[model samples]
Target: MNNFTIYLATLLCLLASKVVGQETFETRAKNIAAKIETITKEEKSALKEEVEAVNNQLEKGSITLEQAENKKKVLAEARAINIEARVGKEQENLKNLVQEKVDGKISESDTIKKSNQLILKWEKGDKKHIAKNEKRTTSQFVFAAGLNNLVTDGKIEDSDFRFLGSHFYELGLTYNSRLAQNSNFLHAKYGLSLMYNNLRPTDNQNFVINGEQTNLETNPIHLKDSRFRNVYLVAPVHLEFDFSGSETKGNKRYFKTHQNVRLGIGGYAGFHLKSKQVLKFDDSNLEATEKSKGDFNTSTFIYGLSSYIGYKETSLYVKYDLNSLFKNNTINQNNISVGIRFDLN
Candidate 1:
């Protein structure tokens, strides 16, 4: 017989023999191997057993030869069905076990495969096409500066906003230095900034309450004749993240100049360094300045949350001072900035 036909016949015939013999799993596998002679030998044994039983019955005159042959055929078919069902059950159970492993719904430690050990051994034995993942590290530094808008909540009034450079201005610089890890593409950094601001009441008062210096205005300054301004410095340390595994992207690291908005709220302390007044109308500058000190207290101290947003290289962001500038200070100039911020990595 051709090999394909012979192999198929052996598979079917071996199943019948295996069931007849009540063989264990290991022995059945060995007997049903690719050796054609070994497989046919088991089939032959199964036929022999039937022939002896039939002959014994014939001698006793219980049945004819034809009856004996038909009985053997029926027994072989039943044996084949039993073995096929057993094999199918075993295969289905194995498939279920594999699926349970992938889902992680399986909690039993005994079921886990020791696949990592095998992988390690194989990689070590054949030193080809294998690499280990390591902690990343680096130190070449870079940095950038930018401006943002300012908004504030006041002690006496509700709230207001101003774009950078108009009633307000900001300057910031960031430094990305290397960590001590000694791996590739990994590090840390420190950031710093200085801000200036000017905020005034929307309406000027006809009468003034000189609380600080004792010079309230009468015919006080015209509503248009009042102005306010102040300045501060801030510093922050930002833990940076990066993706520069390949070449051709340039070595300049990533600078937060444009795109991608960043919202970060940390602790900050600002000292009111400068305070001044600009005359709005024809009156004494000292008198109007004294009456219009709404949100801006003389050298007010503030602490609170800060946040920002950016697009590619350009950004728009705002900060909310947590503390009041006035004793009744509600919220003051929030330092909303929109300037280029570069990175050093």
Candidate 2:
């Protein structure tokens, strides 16, 4: 309760604070040391114990063989990875501390040398860089060319040229690739086929007499006498796949062999040029002007599904036109064809 007692109490309080502060720093330093030791030993020991647990469960029939194997592998890898990351962070912190203290009193001349060496080490330490050096691109483009066939048959109005033949020379382009988790690259390709037909179409009356359906060849007639010489075009789009294997496999890792089956579904659109029609029996020798349904029914924009599969340099392709070939009341045609393709990419 006196001034001397108060002064003595204040001095003791200040001395106690100084002693506590030093002990607190010492406690923090001990904690850091303990953390480092645990990371270096105890954590790894615990992970190993977890792995042993999985192995024990495996031996006891509590887990399937595959499950045990997966568990062991995943556990080991994850533990290693997590521990490595923690170790890396600690190492980085240590390096930063060392660098600060070492550079604090060192001459500036050694800065560039140390910095360059550190960068070199970092680059070499990167796992991604190592993986990238050995990994390949997982995508590719395809090109194909082949003989194409076009066959669409339907009844003509009031006449009989019931059958006609049309053919096309084909050209194609494709782009394909794979995503992670799946080996096969999803593919898309398109083709253009130009056809030239030299056959003429005729329609005649078939009279049923005496309970017999007979072609009245005796009286021949022509309703629309049309000949298409060089005027049919086809364009097809498809999405397909190569099922042989993933890029992490035999040829994809070696000779880059594209040996697999690829099937696609898409649509096709086209145009018909140079159409002709003859309208009379006596006009058999007469060639009437071809009226290209160019008005409203001329061009066919058919979009249907297509697919294919093949291997190596050869692949199969199928295309169907969903859109009607003709705008007329008559179902002129939706196309279908199967053919081989060649890869150019």
lDDT (CA) per prediction: 0.40, 0.43
Per-residue CA lDDT of candidate 2, range 122-167, in tens?
A: 5566555344423433222232323323334533233333332322
Total residue pair clashes for candidate 2: 18
Q: TM-score per candidate, in order? A: 0.38, 0.37
**Predicted structure with the largest TM-score when compared to the true one:** 1
- Regions of candidate 1 where Cα sits further than 4 Å from its true position: 1-166, 178-189, 205-219, 223-225, 240-267, 282-296, 311-313, 328-345
RMSD of 2: 31.6
Indicate the residue-level lDDT of 159 in model 1: 30
Deviation (Å) of 37 in candidate 2: 64
Best by lDDT: 2
Model 1 scores a C-alpha lDDT of 0.40
